[model samples]
Target: MNHLGDAHLRNWTLRLAALLAADTQDQLAWLGERELETKDVVEEVELLCRVSEGLAERGAFEPEDLRDLRAIGRRLGEIDATCRVGLWEYALAVDPAWDDIRSLARQFLLTRLGDWRQPLPRPVRPHTGDH
Candidate 1:
């Protein structure tokens, strides 16, 4: 297999990032505004899973990265179920803020899966005696 160049990797990464951001925004927006049924959540989960599977097969990501993507899908599945429960129990009265929570969670999951490295944690400076 040929090694990917920096430009190639960057292009793919940026494209995937943009796609994810848009997808998350749309899904979360809907989730926030409506009390979705079980069937609705299931369909969304299926769509996300299909994308994740495609990403895994692209070979741009490592094995661990694939695992992270799958894990995110699973966790989102749980969140979808929770939303369904809330819908069933509260009807339209259910708070839509769950959209923000799920959106943030999706961002976290993407950051973990993406190859963008974070800066190293800052080291603690030695304490000075000055008050």
Candidate 2:
């Protein structure tokens, strides 16, 4: 997709994320009432809601959640590259704000998936008397 399209998608993603984080019921009502410009956009919005709901219910995203999101993203990307979802690299290249959103999403996923990179407990060092 072109730069303009990318910008619009990024805006929509941010807006949707905000709505999802704020109040899901209101967001759903808002979506139901609005007339979206395109079917692809509507599909994307619905998909976003589904993903957000799934993540919320699970308390974080699992590997399957990532896979599902990627699959949806790939399908949407076929419609327009900018429509791609769950792609951090593309998001970072297009918009700086996406970094924050992506970071939160990543943390959620990592928490659910188990963060193995955390350091193990170490023994405390004895204090020396010499000053």
Candidate 3:
């Protein structure tokens, strides 16, 4: 891979990592600092499902990463929130029903790349090679 290709791969991992981490309150606050609101986990997790393809193509994902991803997906799938606005939006932060999702996300974030409790890179706009 050339420099640009390598950077592209790196971006995918960071984006995937961010999507996973954004589920937790700590990471949510971190994203807030960068003006990145990744709180709508229903949408973000869906985005992760697609973005992970790029990461997989680049051979950037670990075996455990896929396992953890599926675990998170399965947990979200179990939610039966009765709101058309969106499941995560329906399950507010204080809602006990949302706890499992956040806990799973926090575990995945830490297991895959350590959580926000560790130092993280300053936020960068994901590169799509387009304006």
Best by lDDT: 3
Query: How many pairs of residues in model 1 come into backbone collision?
Result: 0
How many angstroms is residue 42 displaced in model 2 relative to the true structure, after the best TM-score fit? 11
Leading candidate by TM-score: 3
Q: Model 2 over residues 11-101: C-alpha lDDT tens digits?
A: 4444443432332243334445343333444365456635544453443434554554454344434444444343333333454343443
Q: Compute the lDDT of residue 111 as modeled in candidate 3.
A: 73
In model 1, which range of ten residues has the least summed lDDT? 115-124
Task: Tell how far residue 60 is off in model 1, in angstroms.
Answer: 5.1
For each candidate in the order shown, give its overall lDDT on alpha carbons. Answer: 0.45, 0.41, 0.54
Error (Å) of candidate 3 at residue 53 is 4.6
Tens-place lDDT digits, model 1, residues 1-131: 13445335534433433333334344344345444454454355445545554555565455665565465456545544455553421422353434443453346445654533222222234456877
Ranking by TM-score: 3, 1, 2
- What TM-score does structure 1 among the candidates reach? 0.35
TM value for model 3: 0.53
RMSD values for the candidates in order, in angstroms, are 15.1, 19.5, 6.0
TM-score result, candidate 2: 0.26
